[model samples]
Target: MRPLIRPKMIVSAVLAALVLAGCASTPEPPPAPESTSAVEQWAALEATELIDQLEALPLDERPRDVLASVRQDEVVVSAADGSREVSVPIQDGHYLSIAPYLDRTHDCFFHSLTTCTGEMGNEELTVRIVDDRTGEVYVDETARANDNGFIGFWLPRDVAATVTVTGVGGTAEASVQTGAEDLTCLTSLQLT
Candidate 1:
């Protein structure tokens, strides 16, 4: 004779089936990352009013070399004053000249861009500058943009070089020649 099926057994079977079905269902995909706004990106570099001061210097007093990096929202000026950090809006080509010669040792300025956050400014970057003439790695370093989204380097004047910048957002390479006179070579790299 067949045994009678109990109500509790049927309920237990149904619950087990439901649990297995729940486990089998696909999970939702993770949310996409939010893009940063221009204004928010400008704030990350901790930039200040340094450009204005740099621009205000008279031509005679200005340093011969000036390097500025241009980004989507802001310009990073390699020249900084003490702990004062400053940022300026980007221009047709963000250019400036400052005098009184702070640290004349460094003559090259490098800028790298991949992306930026409202909170952190421009993305951190690893840059490598190779001396094209001798195949020497002139500079290999990781750095964050100053308030103005610019990174600075000191290289011998009148040297040919190649710069490679890498970051989480992308990588870029550029070629430049150090100026015979103190000069600002603004190298902008697109991170992609």
Candidate 2:
């Protein structure tokens, strides 16, 4: 003669079991497969982003007659933007003179590839020529600003020299041989 259990007790037991099952949540799936470490992932993402940017860059947009020519110390450089011609006035020794063109509110710091932009006022520029073969410093001096925003100095008597200019934003340098004329370096400088 087993006694029948109360309906309330049965309901409570069922509820309790359900609560227990709910509490025992299924183990979370193993962390999703990570292809790389955090740093590596970041680097990969950056590279991919850069590649995408490069791919999206436009090759041709500006007019071809932008720079007719650019000159530096008896050197004339031709470009689609404009032209620049330069000459050395105080080319005594260890000094490479330069002139940069920029907007009224911006100053130009000497560089081979791009000029650094600074405040509205003019800035004193420094020039240096290094001998790559001997790892020796040949030319080093400070150049004063000219009325036309041009500066000048003399390269050391070294055989081959690399000139460098540093200013506010960045630095640019180019290598040239003595008496090299119409020195145009970059064939195509574009993101695309």
Top-lDDT structure, candidate number: 1
lDDT of 2 by residue, 136-188 (tens): 78668775443323344444443466667665445666665544342322111
Off by over 4 Å in 1: 1-122, 181-183
Q: After TM-score superposition, what is the CA distance of residue 170 in candidate 2 from its true location, in Å?
A: 2.0
lDDT of 1 by residue, 41-116 (tens): 4334433343443333433444433333433345654332223233555423223111111112223342322121
**Deviation of model 1 at 131, angstroms:** 0.4
- Candidate 2 TM-score over all chains jointly: 0.33
Best by TM-score: 1
Residues forming the 10-long window of minimal summed lDDT in candidate 2: 183-192
Q: Lowest-scoring 10 consecutive residues by lDDT in candidate 1? A: 96-105
Off by over 4 Å in 2: 1-96, 100-122, 156-158, 180-192
